[model samples]
Target chain A: MILFELIAPIVVMFALSFLHADRVRALLALSAFAIMLPAVQLLLQDKPFPLLGDYLIADRLNTYVLLLASVVGAGVALALMTLQRHVQVHPRAYFRFYRFFALFWVGLEMAILSNHMGLYWIGLEMATLSTVYMIKTNATRAAHKEAWNYMIVGAIAISLILFGIILIYAGAKPVLGEEAMYFTALLGAADRIPSPFLFEMGFAIVTVGMFVKMGFFPMNLWLANVERASFYPVAALFSGILESAIMVGFFRFSDVAKIVNFSHLAGFIFVYALLTMFVVAFLIYRAKDFMRLFSLSGIEHMALIALFWTSGGTFAALLHFGAHAFIKPALFLSTGVLESQGRYHIAGALRGYRGLKGKLFWFVVGLLMLAIVSLPPSPMFFSELYGFGSMIALAKSGHHLPAMIAAIVLLLFLLSIIFYRFVELYQSMKYEGEAVEKRVYGSELAALLLFAVGALALLLPFSLAFLRSIA
Target chain B: MSAFLTGAFLATLVAALFATRLYRLLMWYALNSLALGLLALLIGSGLNDPALIISGVLTLLLKAGVIPLVLKRLTQRFALTRQVTPDIKVHYAVVLIPAILVFTFYLAEPIGRMVGGNANSVAVAISSLFLALLLMMEHRNVAPKIIGFLMMENALFLLGTTATGGMPMLVELGIFFDLLIAIVVINLLFRREEAVE
Candidate 1:
């Protein structure tokens, strides 16, 4: 039953590619909703379910990610359904877009659910391959360049990850034979593995590959560059679903690292997260294009999630992950509508829009901006609060008082810069352009509203408790 | 036999680093992959591992034969520049290459001891990986970079085949699937580049 549910979307989307564009869009949205039913069932189940004689496992972490993927996936598909009417893509191209999107989704599922490390790597590579073409959906020169940049970086990262996986297998195979590639087996025998040094090196290499893929510090520009050039729906998925899946890979491998007494893993993640946030914060401040601003903000959010995860704040980290998953797609979807109506910059762009729909657009963008900045009533507020509290606690426990305090102060200052920049961009919005009336699609707004509601609901006590329990 | 094959593999990768023309570089990659495939077969037969044997066959058919054909076709179809010169001059790379090979041997000693595998073979595999990365970094043109990326995969497959015998058959199969899809994507991007130009 579990296997069927997971495979169904890939099969349906592949078959639907032969149909016309509208039907593909319709069925894509429909299949996303359909999958949510099983995702919820999987999420509600208590015990881990192993399949294919243990090659794949549905456990708490992956199930939680599965549910998140479903929700975000559905929202993006819905946004595509509506946003397609405005964008002038060829029907053949549109059909192909959804087909690749389906493959991307399946790849995420495979990556999240696979118990074997090799399978996980393959899943990530599959996802990367699918996105390489999807980024070039517009066929623009800039789009092709970004796609090429994304591909080269992605291949390098994937190759490094493969090397890391091989090193890990070499370290583990001595103890557990062929079963060493399996996560459960590795975790179970981590303490007994004779080659701790090799394992640690492997884990470190894997983390570096993931950091490169996730756009940490030095390699951070690829995500922003690619996202800016990509079709908006694709950008939404890049920010929302792809980032979440990559982090899931990190968490799975790091789980094994932790068991093996790999002490440097946390410090490694913290430094990169800190550096990434620092870079992203400045980039966000200077972002002139709306998509670039939002993309930079996505990097910041992912960095914070990594920080929270490493700092003994699993609950807060997962919550932030969930909240960002919903919030970013909403931001992209709303901004996409604005772009479709000829506004894609941070300068006084509000003047170009008029009417109740225009007001709703500004209002949606404002609320999402607030949510992203972790303002009150948004779940991010609590996530950041708890995340910081945990970071300080981690510091105290490790007796790195001065260093931790300094890091926290720097992070706080960066956050303020980002928040202040968002405000400046918003305020500057009121000062420009000749007012042109625009009609916003109800379906687009509805998709945005669905995600907005999900973000807000994540703030509720019940949702917090549910997320904590999952964490 | 294993050492000889690995040495040949390393030789092809080194030769690839110096190739100044498109066809010569692709020929080097194909030979590099052929060496890796033969090494996998030799090790698999010695270990009596059917999975490793299958992986070797697949590697030969796909990496050594099919992928190069596709890349060759892409170069022809796109009329991409045939005279390839890496941005990092050959003189500098000549110095850098031997340094990497020596350093990796030192680095892989402990890993080889831990895995109970041949330290020299592991070192060769690791060095080849670094050399492939250097190959990618030096090239400014797209075809050589793509070949460099594929060479990195060959280097990794060599590492896994030598260091751990081979990964599970399913994982090896998946990697091949990814490689095939990557070629399709590369072909698309080449077409797009030509269109843009």
Candidate 2:
């Protein structure tokens, strides 16, 4: 099943590459369903399934991430299908998009499933390469430049990650022998790894690398720019799926750090997350473009998720990840809908429209934004509540108390400002003009509804229990 | 022999930082890659490891031979400006390079103690990494940056071989595959950059 999950995307990519563009679109829906099936099966498995002598494993954490990537991959494909109906994209470009999109999914799934650190690095490198073109396809000078920067930064980050992995292997070699390459082997021998300092250094270096990859503060330069430059569907996948997979990879490393009793590691990530969230909140408030706004919003959500996980609120962290995974794409795709109508600013997104379509658009966009701000009853609301609750518990245990208090205060302050900004935008979205019935494509609406419903459904007892089970 | 090759590897990379001419930089990169390949081969034979031997041969053929040649063809085809101008001045680089090397030497000291390998070789691997990063940062040209990236990979490969005797064969193969894909992407990006300029 794991093999099929890994192979199906590549098969789809090759098949689409050979098909004509018109035919490719029809097959993409079926292709997405095919690619998602194995992932669904993996996600449903009660026991861990180790494959290929433990080089790949469908453990609970990774399987959940795999499901996220597969669902978002299919969602992005469906959204793009709707985009094709409204826009006049060249046939060759359309065909090329699906080809690379499939490749991106392959890389992401491979990275998530790999138990060997070296193979994990390789998978991420593949994903990074595919992402460069996804942005560059925008065909603007700024887009090209942003893609170029993304590649350079990504390449550098990946190299550093490799260096860190080698260092870890170096540290582990004396203790675990050849078994050191496998994550579980290293974890099993964590206390016996001979060189705790080297292990810690490697973890630090890997954290720095992931800070860049996951868009943490001080190394998040390329993220919003790249996301803003990409086509919205690609942006959706970038935020919704790719970032989640990378976080899962980092989490796997941190699990080792935890077992090895690197107490400072959690604090480092916590401070980093708090700083990222606070800074990105202001950036979101000041953002002029809707794409940039949501991109900054993604940084904030990822920071919050990191905070939750590192504070020992693993359940809240995973819950927040699911919430962001579902809602962020919906928000970005909502912007895509508005973008098609020449609305790129939050202020006037609904100014000219009227009647039921406008009302529905306003409601959907508003609900998603409300969820972004973690309004009551939203999944984000519960996640943030439990996340902060865990964080305060950690603080009372005397871990970086001053920094934690300041961060919590700063977070609440900045969050209110963000809430004010969203409310201001919601007010601006009120259209008092004459009714001009705007017909949105069914696929686009369906795509938005799909993710929005997914986000909302997380509030259900079943989803909550499932999330707790995974945690 | 590994010591001499490691020294040569670091030396060529340091020289590449000062190579003002594009072809000269590529030549320096080729030499650096050649030293890495030879070091891998030497280490592999000493350990009697077939995987490392194969990795060494591939590194030589691909990094030293094919990639540089492909890059040369790309530069000629694009008619990109051959004269290289780095944003950082040479004198500052001259002072800073040794500083970076010294810092990493200290950085690798504890790990070296733990591994009980030649501490100098670990120091050299890390210094080479810093020099490679400098090579990337000091250049404004796309070609140099790409070369720096490849050199970065070579330095990492050297570190793995030196530090761990070699990763699993599967990982080595995957790394090689990723490098090939990266070069293809680099080739395309170089073309696009040239076209844009």
Candidate 3:
């Protein structure tokens, strides 16, 4: 069951790439793989399996991440299908795009499931390499340059991570001795490891590298450029799924290694997150392009919310992760459709939309806005509330009180107004001037509904408890 | 054995500081790798492990000899001009080198006592790290950056050997494989750069 859950999507994706049929068939294969996720989770409940000389493992953490990946992966695949239909001229590269997307999805899942640090590094590199190709698929000069930047920065970060891994292995060898690269073994003997300074230093370096990968501020130049240049489906996955997988890795590191002194790490991340959010908020106001603006805002908010996780903000991060996972992709997919109809600017796209009524487009857009801004009864609202509580609790405990208080106040004020503006935009019918001839299909609506229902269900007590335990 | 290892460490450090041009940089890398190889051999001999000795000799031949030779060929093919203007000026490096030396010695003292190893090995390992960082910062061209990266890897290999005697064979093999792949990727990147130009 364990190996099947971990390996099935990878094998299926590879196999699907070999099929010389329509790209829609590959989409079906992806959906089928996504379906296996819940079944696998059901079987792996409270059961752990270590495989391949302990290079991989199936545990609660892996299961939770796998579930998240499957959910987002399904949404992305569906979004891609809609995009392919909308953008009619790009027929030749369609299969290739889906193939790369499928492979990227598989690689992300593997990275999350990897137990050995080396395997994790390899999985991450594979994901990076695959995504580079994806970014270049648009065939624009700007896209190529962005992909180049992504590859170079990603290479540097991965190399640093490898160096950090070597340092850790070197430090741990005296205590844990030979063949102890697995997370479990290292964690088991973390307390006894000689040269705590080396371990801490390694952890710090690795964290910085991973932060670069996660699109944290100061290292986030590549993200905005990539999102702005790449296709919308790609933007959605980069913002939604890829970011979450890296977060899972960070969460696991915090759980097992505990290498970072939380207070200090939180302080560092908080400052950057706040700065990023402020910059993004300002940029959003000036943003003429809709997709770029929302995607940039998502990246900023992701960094901000991620700090909650570092500061012992638990249930909040998990809920926000799920909420954002559902909403961001829907918005990006809608943006893609708009772009296909020769409307590139957000204000233009929203204006003169006479044909898209009671369709999946508006419904998806509405849900996405609600979720992104964490409107009432959405999982994000509860998550943000809980996150603030956690921050307040930590601050009261005398851990960087001023910074935490400032972050809370800033997050609340910014998010509240952002939500209000989004709601206002959705309600206004100013963009109903021209009719959109091609109507959105039933399957796309089903996919959007699936995500909306999933996000709503997550707010339930039973589901929340289940997810919290696994996470 | 300890004395030989200490001598190699001192020689590598001196080479790193004195080396000037690209050829000198390669030469300095060779000397550093050779020191690492000898240290690995000594550790193997001390443990009475034949396989370790063989691997040590392999490290010496491959890292210290063949790899540098290959890098030299690549540099020649690229026809990189001599680095007349390094990122760090000579006077700054001259001052920085001694400061690093002093700092490493101070940093390694307590660590050496705790780990119960030769303090000189720790000092050399730390110095190599700083040197590698310096090499990376100094170079602007792609080829030199690749060389700098390779040197950093060699430094890490030395740190592994000196700190823990040597990592598991699997890990050593992984690092080597990673380096091999990295070199290929670097070459590809250089090719792309040429194409763009």
Candidate 4:
């Protein structure tokens, strides 16, 4: 019975998907927020919310993620409305669009909530499949190629995850049998699970597979490719919400690793995090499109957040993730406004407008860009400051070499190259071109302002007692 | 018995690697799935595990039986060329396959010890995984690549059965369900809208 209730949103989504009416889709999304609230509330009360079959259990770790994902959905819906105002979405395309939208969220929600690793694998794979259509929303040749690339890589990564799952399950067979595959049970008996080395090795593979799902470093080619070709809202979905969800999933693995050979797992994560941050930060200067630039910078921050996770900066990391969640979508939505103008280059896009109205529009863009770079007063500023502190502390504690490489060396490169390139882009903007300055769509402005306010609000210290000790 | 089952499984993968005819590739998959089912059955009998037997039954019926039929019908509908156009030359693939199998045998030693299973079986399964990846990479068309994916899943199933005796029944059910969905999605994706046949 509890299982049925847990799947009720998916049921509702499938039923509503056929409607294709704006009102029905809005209602469907709002209802998702409604259903997710109880789970979040359950976590807030410090109570375990377990489904009947033990397929899913809600803990504090996932509660924050659930709340953020729910909000990202609503925010993206709002942004989509803003996009719809300019681009003529065919009435016929509505059903498929909304169906994929529903499928993406349902799969994501399921992934976040799944307790069984196999169930989680299914959920993430389902979400990946759904996103293929969303990425192909534009239907251009480039869109097809990007979506195809994304699908191929995502499938390969998921296959790797499957192999990892089998290995770990097999490793646990002697001590725990099949129950060894359940995360809660496995974590409880991590030390007792036979062949601890096998478990660790399998988990290492799973962790790497997940990184391929979420980031572009080492395999750093696809994130910008997919985002640059996708419609902005789809870009926002994958970049802001979906990737964050995967991070939270990885966080759970990290959380469980406290019981499973913690030092090795922590060290492994740290190396990857710093490596990704350094490589992507240098590559940020090479971003061709403005959207790709935003994505590359987001990757840098993602690496930083992963770094925070590894360095035991739990609060600062979650804070950074939360700040990024708000700032990224808003940035994407606003950028959608510019990209929707059918221009190729940032200079060309900027050249399509003129006058005071254009300046106001550019102001909005600048605000988002500044917020993303963690410029002062933006909550990212504080979150990032805390991250720096955490890294410094980590360096002082004896692992000075890697920490210094991440904190000082790559940090210098990031600021000089990425941020400076951003400034160069800022200076290149022109308010004089072919198209006239247009009034900001109300929904677009509303979403942007909501994001701006959310970014500011993230600065206010939410006393998360749970994360206090982890630091 | 396990060695024979694993060997037959690996042979099917090797056969698929060299098979040019599209129908022959599907046959290799069917034969591969059949070997995996038989392997599961053998393990189930040896361990007296009903869940393994149940998984064997499912694999035999759905993967070995139903899926190959579906692929056949799909080929007929698409009117595709009978032969697979692998990007890699045949002679090169033959060399790569054996090299991969040898490398994985070395690679599987540590993992095999950890599981305390039939080391050769585990080694064979691991090698099949890489070989399956090669098959997937070799294909430019969607069908062969998906067949390659299905083959990879078969390899994992063999690993699970041999290493763990068997995974939990619920996880197996979920895995099979996911495979069903994957096949449907792959078909739909290839067919585009208004799927024929």
Per-residue CA lDDT of candidate 3, range A78-196, in tens?
66665656654255355656566666765676677777776676667667767776776666667666766676667667666766776677667777766557788887877777777
Q: What C-alpha lDDT, on a 0 to 100 scale, does residue A313 get in candidate 3?
A: 74
- List the lowest-lDDT window of 10 residues for candidate 4 chain A: A462-471
Chain B TM-score, one value per candidate, order as shown: 0.96, 0.95, 0.88, 0.94
Docking class for candidate 2: medium
Write model 4 residue lDDT over B1-197, tens digit each, in one string. 77888889999999998888888999999999999999999899889999999999999999999999998998888776677878889889878888998998887778777766588887888788888889989988767877888898898898888877888887788788878867776565556432312
Question: How much of the real interface does each model capture, measured as fnat?
Answer: 0.83, 0.64, 0.17, 0.47
Checking candidate 2 for backbone clashes, the offending pairs are none
Please tell me the TM-score of chain B in candidate 1 relative to the true structure's chain B. 0.96
State the lDDT at B154 in candidate 4: 93
**Poorest lDDT segment (10 consecutive residues) of candidate 2 chain B:** B188-197
**Candidate 1 chain B lDDT trough over 10 residues, lowest sum:** B112-121
> How well is each residue in A71-186 modelled by candidate 2, as lDDT tens digits?
77777777787675555556666677777777787787778888889888888888988888777666667778787788888898888888889888988888788888888898
TM-score of 3: 0.80
| Local accuracy of candidate 4 as per-residue lDDT tens digits, A1-471 | 444544676567667867777678566655555545554455565436775467777766666666667667767777676565666555545556667777777677778877887777777877888888777666566767676677777877787777788778777767876687678888787778767766776777777878888765677768778888877888788877788767866776676665777668757876787678778877777776777777878788887787777766788898888788888888787776666555454653554445655565566667777778777877667777777777677667765657465555666566667778776666565533345444466567666777777666655555345445324
Docking category of candidate 1? high
Could you estimate the TM-score for every candidate? Answer: 0.96, 0.95, 0.80, 0.91
lDDT of 1 by residue, A153-240 (tens): 8999989998999899988897899899998899899889888878888888888888888788898777878888888888788878
| Alpha-carbon local distance difference test for all models | 0.83, 0.80, 0.67, 0.74
- Best-matching candidate per lDDT: 1
Provide per-model DockQ scores.
0.83, 0.72, 0.24, 0.51
Q: What is the lDDT of candidate 2?
A: 0.80
Name the best candidate (by DockQ).
1
Superposed model 4: Cα runs more than 4 Å off: A1-9, A21-25, A32-36, A348-362, A399-407, A430-435, A463-471, B193-197
